[model samples]
Target: MSSLLPRLHALWTKETLALLRDRHGLAALFVMPVIFILVMTMALHDAFMPGASIDVAYAVVDLDNSPQSQALVRRLDKSGSFRRIAVGQDLDAARQGIRENQYALVLGLPAKFGERLLAPAGADGQPTEPLTLLVDPTLNPALQLAFRNQTAAALGTIRADELTRRAGKLFGLPVSPAAERDWPDEIVSIAVQNQRSIRPPSSVQQNVPAWLVFAMFFVVIPIASIFIIERQEGTLQRLRAIGLPFGHILAGKLLPFFVVNQLQAVLMVLVGMFIVPMLGGEALHMPAGRSLIHWWLVAASVSLAAVAFALLVASLTRTSQQAVVVGGVGNILMGAVGGIMVPKFMMPAAMQRLAEWSPMAWGLDGFHTVMLRQGGFDAILPDLLKLLTFAALSLTAAVWLNRSSQP
Candidate 1:
């Protein structure tokens, strides 16, 4: 045992020295992932936060150039939600804007909008036709909802004021119905308040931290491939022949990478917390106090899973090139399935169900619990357990395979 210990120590020392000497390998292990985090985060930012100023060019076709119709158009313009490109009498221009995605919503005041509003109700006491709002359904659903709500509220206020004036005239009241009722003022104020209350965080906030977690956690497999290369080159054989125990050798080879992975994790969190904000990204929604434990558990579990996956890849592949190709492809596939490429909410139900088999899914879920839900350790316990089980199973397979591969 003592002899084996010395051999293991020597092998570990040699592997550590080689890794430290290989600057290129270390850079690949660390630097490339950081670059990927930055790039991918930026690319995906718009999908999550779409609130960052989209230039919406809209046209208003006012068939009724009455004071009320003009006032409605003015209200839309004053809201600052859209840029009125042309206040023309051309409906074709408005349709062109819709086709070009230049305008998401088009306001077309019908030729008799003013006359219809002022006309008395028919025998049934209902207006002949309700005001029509033309909006592009192809646009973002949230934006559509916003526009619909705002326009509806605005039109409702206008209708109410008109009704109140008609009522005042019928009752012979001295109150100037439009002047006495502040419906438009109240409705507009309410709409503005609603917009402020639901303001979404920036794109960077929504994407950077998630991508950083993914990019950093994925490097484990490639780093583990180093072991496969060493094995293929008979380095493991030589070390084993010198009496090194398998466990010690595996531990030593993985130590540096484990450290690197943890550091990458830390960098990602720190950047998400601090640096992303400087880049006009929202601050990372890290849980405070008690919830920190859950996040820590999540990180530890992910790291363990990474290490296990690396060892499994090293065990399964016979050559360094094969390990790299297989591991890299596997990483991407796992990431895609696990909600790294697309959010789980956007995925099909079957795909979401299938994602349970992916370690990345577990990692991302844990992160969501910590960041999005502000969950504590208990909330992420199931994910931690799953990851640990996966790690243990993979490590066991790796150990058995490594032993079987030996002469």
Candidate 2:
């Protein structure tokens, strides 16, 4: 055991110094992710943050030219969530506008909207007066639903006012002004739903953890390339002649790259926190009781998982070109399959189901659980275990492959 320690330590030292000597590769370990997260996040920042200003251009068709209908249009305009692009009497034109992708939403007030507002609920418990929110199919489904809810909420507010007006007209009795201030308990249900399975309120929360997982997996190229280079140069034979155990030698190769990937993860995360907002993006808001340790532990686990895959690629490849092809192409493909490139929530249901097998998916799931969902160790445990299990299996296969190839 004492002799084993020296072998591991010396190997680790040698591997670290060698990696550090390649300044470009070392920089890439940190730089590529920072570039990816920042540029990608910045590109999508507006969609994610949306901020105080509403950018979804919309048109309203007030079919009921009544006082109530006009008032609703006025209210929508003042809210700033919807800009009045084209307010027309023709509903067909409004639908056409949406079809052409000219508008994000089309607010359609039905005929007799004023009459419906003046009436009470019918025998059946249903809204006879339903607002039709015609959304552009081109817009994100999640964004479409958010627009629906925001409009619904506005309608909900004006509902009391309309109700009060109706009561005064019907009974000749006015509601007290003070009573209007408090909202009654109610459920406002709108159509065509979307929220995160992870349940984040915005896009930034989801994307940050996702790209971080992709970046973690991207370490495969550099790591596999290094291993292939060493093997081809007969350095693997030289290291073998020193008589170290296979486990110690493998640990030496894995640990330095593992640490490098961890640093990459940290740098990418910090970029999200500080750099994202400077380019008119939202900072990643934290869930309650978040700890730095939780971040580190999850990052460390994910780094190990990534390193194991790198080792697997390095073991099987016969040349540096093969390593680059397998490692680079594999990372990109896995990223797509894992919900790193396209959100799983946005993917087809079958693809979403299939994505569960990806290591990057597990890593992102664990990271998001802690970073966005305020999940503790117990909450992230299932995902973390899956990642660790994958790592162990891949590492075992890599060791077997590496030892069998050795003289």
Among all candidates shown, the one with the greatest TM-score: 1
Best by lDDT: 2
Candidate 1: residue 198 lDDT (0-100): 36
Alpha-carbon TM-score of each model against the true structure: 0.76, 0.72
Compose the digit string of candidate 1's lDDT tens values, residues 1-407.
Answer: 56655655665676667667767666665566556556656665655654333455567788788766776776666566556777777677777777787776677787767667656567457565444546777667766677667666666666676777778788997766335234445322121222133333334544544565566555555555568667768877886786667888777756656666678777776776687667665666666787777777787788888878888888898877787788778888888898777777679999999988888889888877666655567778999999999889988999999888776
Give candidate 1 regions above 4 Å deviation.
Answer: 1-29, 40-55, 74-86, 92-106, 117-208, 285-290
Q: Report RMSD for candidate 1.
A: 5.4
List pairs with backbone clashes in candidate 1: none
RMSD of each: 5.4, 6.4
Q: Write the per-residue lDDT of candidate 2 for residues 1-407, one digit (tens) a residue.
A: 44877877787787777677766566556676677677767665555433345567888788888776776676666567556788887878888888887887888888878668645567456566677888777787876887787667656666777777667768978665323333553443332222334333355666777777777776776777778877889887786777656677678877777777777766766677787887676777654455456766777788888889888998999887888789778888888899887877778999998899888888887777676666678877898789888899999999899878765
> In candidate 2, where is summed lDDT lowest over 10 consecutive residues?
188-197
Local accuracy by lDDT, each model: 0.69, 0.73
Clashes of each: 0, 1
